[model samples]
Target: MKLSYPVHDIDNRLLLPAGTELSGDVLEDLISSNHTTPSQTLPLLEHGSVRKDIVKFISQPPYQLIFPEKQDISKLLKQMEKVQFVLPFLRSLDYFKQYDFTTYNHLLNVFALSTLLAGDLIPDYEERIRESAAGPAHDFGKITVPLKILKKRTPLTRAERDILDHHTLAGYVLLSYYKKDPYSLTARVARDHHERNDGSGYPRGINLNDRMVEIVAVSDVYDALVSLRPYRPISYDKRSALEEIVGLAEQNKVSWDVVKALIAHSRTDKPHYQEVEIPSEKRGAPPPGNVYGIIAEETDADASGTSE
Candidate 1:
C-alpha cells in the first residue's frame, strides 16, 4: 500500500515521503524500530500555528455552542496549550485529514466537547490533558477502514459492517503494538471507547469503568447523532440527541455522570440529571441503526452486536 502523504518516525524524522510504497517488510522495519520517546509534535501542538487554528475553530458557530461560556472555552484552551502530543496521535490525525476529511472534522468536534466535559468530570489535570488528546484520536482506527464504507450513501452490508466494527481493535493494535505509545491510556481509549457498561459494545464486549474512555465514548456518540450524514439528511436536534444518549444511560449502557456532563454543555435550561428524563417513547432510530441502517442476517454473530 502507498500513502498520500509522508510518514514520520516518533522523533518527527521522515521515514517515508509522499507516494512511497509501503511493503510488508518496510512496514515491519518501521514498526520494529526502537523509538519510544515522545515526539516533537508536542511543541508544535502547544505553541505552533495549529493552536491558532484550533482557537478559531472552537470559537465558531456550532462548536461555540458546546462551550456557551467564554470562561469555559478559555480554560480548555489553556489546558490544550500544555498537552503532550504523541507520534501515533499526529500520524493518525494526518491520515484522517488526507483521506477522510469528514471524519477529521467529526474528530475535532469530539476533541472540543470531550475536553470541555473533562474539566467538569475529570478532576486531575494530567488526566484531563490525556482525555483531551485522546478525543480526536479515538476513531484513529477508522483510517484503516476504506473510504467507500465511510462515505456510503446507503445501508452497510454484513461484511462491510464487520470491517467497520474492527476499527476499534485495529486502532488499539496500531497504537499499542505497532507504534508503541508510551502512554498506555491513549491506546486503551482507542480500544475501549466503543465498549459499554453492560457489555454490549463492539470489538470487545467488556464492561468499561474508565472515566476517560467513557468521556470519549459519550462524545463520540453525541457527535454521530447530531452531525448530518450524506445518506441521512436530517440529524436529531440537540434536545432529541441528548435524549437518545440519556436513554442509553437509563439502560446502563453508558455512565450517567458522563452523559450529564454532556447535557450541561448542550442544554441551557434544566441541564441537571434529576430534571433530565428518558422520553416515554424513545424517538429516532436506536443507536447505530439511527446513524446508518444495517442490512445483515439477524444471526450474523460478528455483525450482530455493535453500538455507537
Candidate 2:
C-alpha cells in the first residue's frame, strides 16, 4: 500500500519517513510529480489517512528542532491562545522557510496578532488556529524572492509585479501538496488570501466564504503597515495603523467588525502589524515609543561593501 504524508508540509523537510536527504532540485521534482492542492487534501486523506510513519517523522526532529523561535512565540500565550498562535502558522509556513523565525519575527508576530483578532470570527478554536497559521504564512512562497525585486525603490514594472505575485500560487503549491483538504483554513488561505474585496487581487480572484480569511486579511493589512519595504521607508504608528485598517473597512477591503477588534488590540499594544495604508499604499513609520526597527543590507556587484 502507498503511504501518505501530510501534503501541506511537502515544501519543508524531505521525509521518506525521515532520515533522508535530497537535493533541492530533486526534492522539487518529487513534489512536482506528486503536487497536491488544499482542495485535494480531503479527497487524498479520505482516500487514505496520514501514514503512521509519516506522522512519526513530522512530530520530531527538524520540525521540533528548527522551530524553537516559533515555540518561543507560542509560549507567550495560554493553551487556547497558544494553539491559535502556533499550530496554524507552523503548518502554513512550513513550505516557504522553516527556521527559528528570529529576524523580523514578522510571520510569527502577524500570526499571533491576526489569530487573536480572528478567533471569534470562527467557532472552533482549532479552525481559528488553522486560520492563524495561514495568515502571515501566506507570504512564505516569497522567501526565495530577491530582496531587490521586492524592495525596489521605484515602481515595480508590470513584469516585476507579476513575478512577485506568483508567491501566492507558489505558496498554494507548498500547502496543498501536503494537506490536500479544501475545507481546511490553511488551504483556503493559500488559494485565496490575495483576493481583494472588489476582485482586483491576484492568483485567483476568489470570493472566499471563510470569515477567518477576512479576519486574517485585516491583520495581513496591519503587518504590511509596520514592515519596511523599498517602495515605502516608514510604516505607520499604532494609532495610524489602526486608522488605516479602519479605512480599509470603509473601502470594503476588510470587515468593519474586524477593524474594530484590531483597533482595540492596538489600544492595548499587543499587535505589531506592518502598518500599510490601503488608500495611499504607503507604509507608516513605527508608532510612538516603539523600539521596533527593521534594516536591510544590500550588496552591489559594482560598489564597495558599505551599509545597504
Candidate 3:
C-alpha cells in the first residue's frame, strides 16, 4: 500500500515518508513494531464511549463535588472529542488501553479531572479545551517502562525507582517528538507535573510556572494519592487526600489557587483562597544522576524481582 502521510516512530524518526510503497514484508515489520504509528488509522477511541465514561466519572464523589455546569460539560466533551483526532494522542491512548489498563484508567481519570479543573481555573473556553489535551497524554512516556516495574506489587529498589522516575523525562521527549513540538502543552505537562512549586519535585526540580501544568499537576497528584496503587497498601480517603494536598499548598509546593479550586469541589460552601501560612524551611531536590542508561542497564533479575 502507498501512504498519504509520512510515518515516524515515537522518537519522531522518519521511517517511511509519504508515497513510500509498503511491500508485504514492510507491512509485517511495521505491524510488529512498538511505538510506531501505522500507515492507516485503526479504530480510535469512540467518542460516545469516552463521553459516557467522563460523565460517569464526574458523577462520582469528590469529582461530583466540583463538577462543571451543563454548558461547560458540553464544551469540555466536545474539546475532548477533538483530541482524538490528533494522531499522537490517539496512538498513546490506544497503546495504554492495549498494554497498560491501569495507566489507561488513570489516564481517563486525570483527563476528566484536569479538564474540569481547567474550566474552573481558565475562564476562556478555548484555552480550557487546549489544555484538555494534556491530561490523556501526560503519562505517555510510561509506555517505554516495562510492565513489570509499573505493576510491581512491592516496593522498588533504588535503581528501579530511578528508572520509574525517568518516565517523566521519557514522556516529555516522546510527547514532544509525537507532536513534533518541543514546547507543546502536553509535553510540558508530562515533564512538569511531578514538579512542585517549591522546587522539590523530580527530573528538573524547577518551580512550575505554567497554569496548565499546575492544573494537571494537582489533578495527577490528587488522583494518585486517592487511587489504589500496587505500592500503596491503602488508598487515601477523600478528606485525607485533600488535607495532604492542602498541606502541600501550605508548604508552597503547589499553587494555592489551583489547590483551592480542587478543594472547592468537595465542599458545598464557597471556597475562599486565602494565603496558607508558608513553611519556614523549604525542602531541596537532589541533583539528577544519569538516568539515560538506567533502563538499558536492567538485568533479568531486576526485571523479575521487587524491592523495598
Candidate 4:
C-alpha cells in the first residue's frame, strides 16, 4: 500500500514523505525494525487535509471551539510540522488493525474539544496553543504498549491492565525526551490527562489542580465515549457523551465548570457546533494562581500508580 502520509523515525528524522509507495522490502524492513527494537516508536503523517478541514470547521464564525482560523491554522500547522516527533509516536498504533478509530483522528478530536474548553477558561493565547498541542500528545505513551494488548477485545487481565496503565508515564517520558522540557504542557498533559479531580482515576490517582490537564482529561473521555472502540462495538451519540461527562462532573470526578463549557459549546440549537455563553454563576471559577507553575512542580513518579 502507498503511504498516506509522511513517516518519521524516533529521532524525528523523516523516513518517507507522503505519496511514497510502500514496497515489499520497505514493509519487511519496518516490521523487522519494529520487532527488533520495540522502544523506538516511529511517527507517521495523519491525513493532513482532514486535520485542516477539522480546524476550518471549528474556526468559522459563531466560533464554538478554540480552533485556529486560516492564518492561525497556517501558524499551528507550521508549529506542528516542526514538532515532527509527535507523528511517529502516534503512528505506532498504525500497526494495530482493530482500533475503532485511527489514533490520529482520536487525538484530533480530543485536541479540538480540549481547545474549545480551554478557550472558555483560559484567555491567554499562548496557553491555548499549549493545550491544543497537548491534546494529541496526551496519548503518546501508548506507543510503549504492546499491540496485542491495545487491540485485545476481551477484558484485560490484572497484569495486562497494569502494563497498559503505564502508558501515561511512558507518554510523558517520550515527550520529555523528545521535547527536552520536563514541565512542558505536552508532557504534563500526557501524564495527568488520565487523572481525576476526586483522585479516583488511574496512572496516579491524585487530584488534578491544573485547568489545562482537567480540560484535556475531560475532552479525552468525551471523545473516547463517542468513538467506537475494539472492545465496545457501539459508539455513543454526542448527546449521550455529554450526559456522561455531566454525570462525572456531578460525581466530582471531573471539573463541573469545564463540563458546563462543553455543554454550552455543544448546544444543538444550531446546525453546527457554536460557542454559547454560559452563565457566570454556572461556570466554575478559573483555577487559582499560575497553573503552569503548579504543574512544573509535579514529577513523573507522582503519577506512577496503575489501575486494573
Candidate 5:
C-alpha cells in the first residue's frame, strides 16, 4: 500500500512521507507502533482541513470555521477547537485506515453534528463543551474490538453480537479510567449514547433522560446511515437518512426535539443544501439479516421478543 500522505510519530516526528509504498513488514511495524506509541496512521494535514463538507454542514453557531472566502466555515472550526482532544485519539488508531468508515472521520462528523444540535438544546457554555467532548469519545471503546469483527460483512453470530454490544460499556470504562472528572460527559456519553428513549439500546436497557446522550445518539445514527459501511455498497441518500431518524423519533426511540434540530440545521429543503461525501471502503457484500442497519436490527429483535 502506498501512503496517501505523510505520517507522524507520537512525538510529531516524521515517519513516512506521502506516496511512500508500504510493504508487509513496514505495514506491520507501523500498526504495532500505532498501538504502542499512539501515532497518526494517515498523512498529516493542517488542522480543520479534512472533512470540510461536515464542517460546512455544521457551520451554524458554537461551531465555525473561519475562511477568508467563506465565513460560514469559521463557526465550525471554532466548535472543533473546543474539543481538540479528539484529534490525538483519532490519530492513534491505525485499524480504521483500511475501512471506508474511519473512526477519526466518523467521530468528527458525529462531534460536529452533536455540537450543532447541542447549541440549540444546551444554553450553558460548560454543558455545550461537555457535549462537544462526548461526541467523539462515544465510540472510543471500539478500539478494543477486533478489526475483523468491526469490518465483518456477515451477520455477527450470538457471541460476536454480544461482544459488539459491549462496546458501549467498554468505551465508558476506558473514558472513566483516563478522564480526571469522574462525572465527565464524555464518559457518560460513551456509556449512554446507544441507549434509547424507548429503553431498547444496548449496554443498558434503561431509557435515557440526559439531553447530551440523546443528541449524540441521533447524530451517531444520522452519520452512520449516510456513511458507507464495509457491508454496504453505497451510502443512503440524505432523505433516507433523515427519514430513518424521523422514524426513530416517531417511535420514541430518540428525542423528537433533537431530530427537529437536525432537520433545521441541515436545511435540506434549501436550494443550496449539499450532501457531503462520506468515505467508505466498500469492502464486501451487505450483511445478511437486517441489511446492516445500525440500530434497526437490535430494535426489531427486541421488539419481536417482547410481549404486547
Candidate 6:
C-alpha cells in the first residue's frame, strides 16, 4: 500500500536516519505532491517592456503569473501568447504597491522581469524557465553567508566578503539533485551575477558573451538596488531603480535595450515591494479570488456575502 506524507506537513526538525525508508504510504504522499502539482499553462506576454506593471493594474496583485488555478491556466496561456507578440516593446515595470515581499518575492519579480526582457528578444523565452528559476534561486546557497551579512547594517570585512562569495557554488550543488529543473542556472547565475561588462566581476570573470550574460547582469543589479540590503534600509523606489539601470546602460555596462525594458518594468504596482511616496493609498484590497484564492478552496474565505 502507498503511504501519503507531506514534508511541510510533517514539519519535523530532524530527518529520519539516513538509510531508513519511509512507509510506502507516507512516501507516496510526499512523492505524489512533489510530482502532482497541477500543470499550469505557460504565461503569455503581449508586450515586452514591463508586463508585470500592467498586470498589477489589470489583473490585481494577488494574482500569480506563473502559477494560478487550473480555471485560470487557459487565461495565462493566452496571455503568454500575447507576450510573445508584444514583448519586444512591453517592459515589466515596477513602481510601487502595498504587498509585502520577502527575498523570495523580490527574486521572483526579477526573474519574471528578466524573462520578459528575454522574451522580447527571443521568441521561445518560455523555455527560459530554467534560466528564470536560476535567476532567483541562485542566492539560496547564501545560507552560509550569514543573515547579518545579507541584512547587515554595517560594512563587511574582506574575510566576510570572501566567505560570502561562495554562495553561487553552494546554490549550484544544492539544486543539482532537485527533482525539478536541474541546478543548471544555480551555478551559472550565482557565480556570474556579479561579473560586470568591463570584466570586473568575480568568480573568474571569463568575460562571457554579452547576449547570454545580460539577463543575469541586469536582473541581479536591479534586484539589489531595490532590495533593502543589510547595510541599507528601504532601498530605492521603483523609478529610482529604473534610473539606476538606465545609468548602467548609458555606461555600456549593460545592453541599452535591456535597460530600457527594465526601466519600463519599474512601473509595476508591486514594484520592488516598496510603495512610492504618495499622497494616499488604494481604498481596499483586491478580491480573495485572485491569489489567496487557494485559501477559498480550503476554507471558503470568500464569503457569499462579499459581493463583487
Name the top TM-score candidate.
1
Please give the TM-score that candidate 5 achieves against the real structure.
Answer: 0.66
Error of 3 at 66 (Å): 3.3
Write model 2 residue lDDT over 1-308, tens digit each, in one string. 11122122434443333222333453465555553332222211111121222233223432232123445334323322333222323443442223322212445445555656665455576533544556555665554344555545655554455556666655554544444333456656755666767665656565544677777676666766755545555656555666667666777766766776665444434343334223434454344433222223333531331112
User: On residues 179-274, what C-alpha lDDT tens digit does candidate 4 reach at each position?
Assistant: 545567887888788789889987668898688888888888877666656555566665556666777887899987777777765654422223
| lDDT of model 3 at position 166 | 63
Candidate 4 lands at a TM-score of 0.62
lDDT (10s digit) by residue, model 6, range 140-189: 55543445444434444444455466555444333332222232454456
- Provide the TM-score for each candidate, comma-separated: 0.74, 0.57, 0.72, 0.62, 0.66, 0.51
List candidate 4 segments past 4 Å from native.
1-101, 126-128, 269-308
What lDDT score belongs to each candidate, Candidate 1 first?
A: 0.68, 0.48, 0.67, 0.59, 0.60, 0.44
Instruction: Give candidate 6's error at residue 150 in angstroms.
Output: 1.7
As for candidate 3, its clashing pairs are: none
Number of colliding residue pairs in each model: 0, 28, 0, 5, 14, 45
How far is 207's C-alpha from truth in model 2 (Å)? 2.7
Tell me the tens digit of each residue's lDDT in model 1 across 72-180: 7677777776656555566666666677766866777787778777777776846447556677768877766767778766677776776677667556545654445
lDDT, residue 133, model 1: 67
Lowest summed lDDT across 10 adjacent residues in model 3 is found at: 284-293
Q: How would the candidate models be sorted by lDDT, starting from the highest?
A: 1, 3, 5, 4, 2, 6
Task: Give the residue spans of candidate 2 off by over 4 A.
Answer: 1-76, 79-104, 126-128, 180-183, 268-308
Better of 3 and 6 by lDDT: 3
Candidate 5 per-residue lDDT over residues 1-308, each given as its tens digit: 34443444333455555565645465445444444432222222234444564555344322232122255456655665656443445544333444534566677678767776777777695546645778877887676555666766655555455556666765654454444233578878887888888888876687976888899999899877766665565676666677778778778899877887776655534221123222233332322333463433445554343221
Better of 5 and 6 by TM-score: 5
Model 6's TM-score against the true structure: 0.51
